[model samples]
Target: MSEFSELRYLCGSLVAVLLASILLTRGWRSKHRHLPGPPPKFLVGNLKDLPTGGHEWDQYAKMSELYGSDVLYMTALGTGLLVINSFEAAHDLLDKRGSVYSDRPRLVMIKELMKWDWNLILMSYGKNFTTYRRVVQQEFQPSTVAELYRPIMATEVIALLDRLLRSPEDLIQHFRLMAGAIIMMVTYGHKVDSVDDKYVALAEAVREYSAQRPGTELVDVFPILKYLPSWFPGAGFQKYAAIGKKLSIQMRSAPFKMIKDRLASGTASPSLASRLLHQSVDTGGIDQDQFAQNTCAVVYSAGADTTLAAMINFILAMTLYPEVQERAQRELDDVVGRDRLPNFSDKGRLPYVSNVVKETLRWKAVAPLGVPHATVSDDVYRDGYVPKGTTVIANISAMLHDPSVYSDPDTFSPDRFSPTDQKSEGEPDPARAAFGFGRRICPGRFFAEDSLWLAVASLLHVFAITNPDGRGGNGVKGIRWSSGLVSLPSPFPYKLEPRFSKAPELVSAAERT
Candidate 1:
């Protein structure tokens, strides 16, 4: 038979075997089997619902509505997957019982083929995880970030404005570089001198390739399929995995070597890597050095991301709501004056800009379904049995867009979060839902917030962003929110007009030491 036919034959045989096995064991199923979810295929269970190209967060959000909030249950190859759809459920399972629910679900592709099982975010709840979290907390504490990182963020914003003036069409690329440059300096003490720098390329590639998750890949569902020979049918995934493994190695090692060489030559700059090295002890293995390298790698992958999407959305929001943009400019013009750009010192005074940031995060949560977690042992919530080894997901999007929490949740009204606006009925600040819950909360949140605020305040002070094309915003007519780990708006045409006649000169002056 042809390879395609052969692959189909093998798949059919596997399904037959699975269905038979399921029938044989049907009578003695566990108590949790009664939990609610979409009816699974007789044998494959919810595997049919797996989204391949990494937009499955939307599917999970829809499943939440069907399953009726709280805890949800599904089975794949007899392994339980519980999706938490409500705030109470997420806080209860992921926060209260964090000891067991804090662990990440095993991703066979990332763990085996990509060699990223060592990722701090993916590692199980253990001493190493604790060390990573503690170190990140030490480095990114609010006081430390506010004290040290402000100038760095300001300089990058000035540099970004310089780029925005010269090539306004490439504003998106400038945003990416601004974020990447800040991260490179802070994480490794390495200055990114150009937009096409080697480290930038590597980090972007890693993020794109790593988007594939557990349910999205067929290999994750059928563990036995991994053992199948290379010559067997449908073996393309194995080849892809091999390529990913090599890329991951390069991604981790290149910047690490740059930092190590600088340290050896007595030329290292002050940064998280240099600081950690000074504090590291000889742990008698690859671990001590590995710890620094792994932490830097994670920061590199995540640093530019969460805010990149939101900053773009912030610009989009201005185009849609010109009146809001003018109000923010008036705030900036009043506090910062025309002599200098808005600095971090002016943040508290710029409440409107802060509200814009919060709304962007709430409007399109960077991660609709927060990182998948796993249960290490059996537990029960609301009389629902959460079996051991079950994969868990928190439906963050449902909460963010819930009508009850956010009246007119579909509308983009920044006043909803502004305390001074009397029209704004009191609602829980969406900022609570933006970062995350429990142990998995993003460590770089303070740093990211500072960076975003500075960017917004600075940008508002100098520029007027408007969309001549009216379809990009409103009550969500033409707005297209992505379903990736970060839910960013798709590209939309917008104007980048300077508010000041000397915009370029101001940018140049700010860029100078």
Candidate 2:
């Protein structure tokens, strides 16, 4: 009997071991195992492999090359990260199959801690997002921009030219002010007179303090940290979060409240907020007035930052590549003439200038790694399994800089886009990748592009951007770019002078009218 009991116990132990082995194998399986990427380690799972320091976009690009695939997969702990390197791959997943990939990864730092849930750039995909996009799209559609926003852009560009002539040394500040001015007027009809404009200051302060590592904060990974008290160990971010919350509320509400009060008094100027407020009737139980405020606030914050970054890039490219600047100026002079600053009507006539704007966008992407998009459900792409909740990052910088797509991509050459150029025949337009992909493509892109063109054309038509030492064609060497969601050139020494004797007078003339 004892021998029989021992045999039974042995059989039971064998079955238990087999069951455990099967479960362990299943648990260890990765849905993205078919995708190429750095080998993940046990437990840590590629934590050390994540890019660090600035120009992470470059690092990811290199990783894509090393992995020998456009879709590069990685993981931290148990979370998956999908980096799309090529335009084809990004377009395929983020654009063509947008419904499955349009959702955004939850950002605990920005949404919960900073209280910026209303920000359209980071808002998740859902009914609220749809409502916000509808409200914003109506304001920034091409027709609306042409009818209402173009004059605003032309006016601001002229003001920028005047500001550059007077305070050329404060180049970055001037760009910031110009961007703020355009956005303020377009969104709330708020006139920004100077760098000290209260609305600009409030919005800027919130952006600066609340900026986080593109959704990679520790609190973002482990949202439970948001519960920690400000005084607790490693809870310093909580205090800043508190400050950000207050500033965010004021920034989102102050200008909107002013517009609302003006409308009530029958004095509200025609602005996006005011117009939306006038037409705002309750939509599906959501507050229309609040919706208007949210959409306008989003436009103000997002539009200003991207516009300023692009302008800065155009300046950097001109300073570094004087030949490109000269060609653009020649185009402007030939098409728009020197008597008046360039306007929207000259856009089609000045293709080279348009290409210069395109090249600037390609050379240095604004939002290099676009705001992260999240997978709403498990799906397969290119024979690879993409698990739900994966953080999908469309590497815009990588797509724009792919040498296969743009030969000698690192060199700032606007001619690469010219159909007449011998080297290439009208390479793919960078705007497709520069702005973003699919459902999340910038709704305000029409106005944004118009704003960039007007600024670039006017600046080139008026000023000769060169090295600070006044040496023509001598470029700022060893240029470094800031690393974040938005990339811009680090402050470099530059000089702005009237391209011709009549340039300053033309700018003054335009500003006066």
Candidate 3:
């Protein structure tokens, strides 16, 4: 035979052998073939089954309903993804199996190329994550947040009330500004004078960039592709990541540098950074390192943006159900008189207002599909095989909107949680599921809850939020729920008026100092 013909024959044999090996391996590993889920396309798996638009979480809830299982398993381009659509399943896997399930899946775009891997929110479960979490949670845990940060948070919200009173048209911006400024003060002891302030602007840019990211990019599904040069075809995500990396570094370094300077000069106000950085005399004068700095930056992305979203949802809820608003305000007024704004001390007496906060989360959680958790080893439950590397999600929206759990899942009724309100036997309360379940739950949950409660209770006490167009009475909801990781009530026109004639003087007299 000619040499050319012999070479062709050899190449064909190698290709056939490679194909057979792949087929054999997959057939041998098809233990989950019996697990029910959406039918995947040939070889492509469930790539086409992925949600396409802003309501990805909504689509996931629907998938769970159609499939009749809280845990729905699927694949995309060979990647295993389990769409968890129940609180019980979420708690079982992410909580009960915390030791084996707390690790985060590697999202190349956000964590690697974007350089956000340093943030504690996306850190892997290990010694590094454990140490960083310990530092960040010291100030934000339930006890410290109320004792050390409430006064500053209240002052920031009062400034928000002042802004809303002056420019009622800018309600959404006012909400964002309030959330950002509160975190800024608590993290860096920096006061944001205006929404346009430089640091605030950087944080705003970073927030916007983070929100625009896709749930999962192609590079994430195929990690090898991340190594491709930016000039390569379909490498646009890399360039996008470069832009994010720049913003992230600037966001962390700028404020950290300022704090260090002020601390050295003895001009810095009390802050998490100041306290965490104070040369741990016990540890022989330790210095604040990159770990702490990145965690502090996480305050803006994970903490500020999420609380802002919840507060925005609260306003939308009040606009849709004016009666709910009236009930919350009545409770606030009864417990804390109009002589001053609601304070941390008053939270204990304001049961209805607290219930309102819980209802807002249940109505439409800020991030409907809480952050994804990954499995560290292959496991089986209920005769189902869950392989390692599966992206496990906690479908909080499903838990919140389940008819069996909530009396009227779609309706905004804070009374569902009121102590005095009678609930049917066996009804499930979804309050704990709101923050998340288990080991990877949000560490800043305490601060977010308190910040949201203070904003909602204080605003309801002073202002009656309603739809100015009067369409709410016709049962037309005005606001759209967000589809992003950090979901906020989409911008909608609403009227904010003083609940009482004395609101202006009350707001002005309240402390902003």
Candidate 4:
């Protein structure tokens, strides 16, 4: 054959192969056309580029801006992902279409290690989820929660004040102790008197388990890795998994065992675990041993760290904005009085104090990205396709900081939530973003709000929180926030001086009562 003819033939053959490959790939793409998302590169999809740890929300926000609010697509490992960044989008999916969007994304390690198949937060939206949620709702029902927890909360607030008076220099530990005590009391009917309580150790273990090296869960992204034997070289998943299992068992079993012992001895205080144990058989609600154990684990895990993180943020907000603190204190003084502590009934009269609580939640949401939700059925959102089983995230951080919604979104301005500060008739409620949206919203929200408000009001009532003076004559400074799934104020130097001589007397009286 002529050289020109041979070249032509070879080129034609190459073109034919390329055409065949394109046709095959096109067919595959057509099958996934219902899902909208950024174009994926070969093999990696978007998982390789997924941001890790605390700042992932920032990256997700940027992607939302680029791809529009209801963007959807697949991850590298063939897991589906849907990012909902706008309030409207989140409302539409997580609320209007909640049936499909209420399920949780699968976490193989968390599931296997913690055995949380039926935990309210981790379980999919089904009979199990419904049952668990109903039980949680009952336990945290407004009347029940207030009745059982108000005294405990009041006592803990007093304890917090006492600690602040004794070591005003250690605000971080005081906040931690107060938060731990309240949650411990609610969860196990036990009070955490000191930071060194065994409950605190259990909490620390959970924190360590959560803060373990980021890439430790290869199985999370690549499910096939889970099938590999633990004996493989560099398989740290097994080690971490073991630790997680041990920690979860300790955390879970301890609370239930306490309840069981109390039930046996007839000394049990009213607790969720106790209620569940007694009701589970009759209701056929959650009778499995592991299921009941997982229920306690869920409440403890959810209750401890996130609640404490919010309380820390509350203190940080007060410290940073003394003016806001002063205003709240004034409102509390007027409504609640110095002789008495704040209570649920005082909520309406203390609108400014309420605003402070709302703004603190808005200023820095404890769960900024909220929790991941998995779609249970194929759906469309804003002309974008959200396939069944897609991992959906409501980027709450973005919604709270949306400039169009909140003027100067970065500023800590509680006044933004003040009813008098409303510029128009149709302004959004600032508290709307704090707890979460729709059915999956934090069930502990009412309890969380009351605890935060009481703490803030009581703290402000007695203390003149200020930045500690520096050696060079500058103020000690505001907190430097730490990065993680939960954003916490890095331990910073601060001075909490008593605002009045009667503060100590007030704390003592409240404790004695």
Q: Against the true structure, whose lDDT is highest?
A: 2
Task: Choose 1 or 3, whichever is better by lDDT.
Answer: 3
Worst 10 residues of 1 by lDDT: 26-35
How do all the candidates rank in terms of lDDT, highest first? 2, 3, 1, 4
Candidate 4, position 506, lDDT: 81
Residue 171 displacement (Å), model 1: 1.5
Give model 2's clash tally.
0
Per-residue alpha-carbon lDDT of candidate 3 for residues 1-513, written as tens digits (9 for 90 to 100): 664465346445644564455456774236465356787766556778888766677798888888988788887655678888777777787889898888888888888888888887788888777777776766678789878888888898899888888887888889888988998899999999789988889988887787686566656755666787887655677789899899999999999999999999999999888877774612222244675587688888788778877887788778778888887777877888878888888878987788788888888788888888888888786678888888887878888887767777888876676444365433455557888777777888888888888888888988989888674654434456667567666567689888898888888998533
Give lDDT: candidate 3, residue 127. 76
Model 4 whole-model lDDT (C-alpha atoms): 0.70
Compute each candidate's TM-score over C-alphas: 0.91, 0.92, 0.91, 0.87
Candidate 3: global Cα-lDDT?
A: 0.78
Report residue 144 deviation for candidate 3 (angstroms): 0.8
After superposition, candidate 2 runs with Cα above 4 Å error: 1-32, 212-215, 280-282, 420-425, 469-477
RMSD of 2: 8.3
> Which residue pairs clash within candidate 3?
none
Candidate 3 displacement at residue 412 in angstroms: 0.9
lDDT of 1 by residue, 1-513 (tens): 887677678767876786677668762254344467766775567767654454465566677777675567887767788877667677777878988888887777777666786677777777778878788777889988977777678778888888888888898889999999999888898888677899989988877776653235666655567777666767677877887888888988899899999999999998888887888643334376788888888887767877798788888777877887888888788888888888877778888788877777777677778787888898877767777888887778777777767778756677777554644445666766567678877888899888988888888888888777653445345667776567777777788878988766788887885
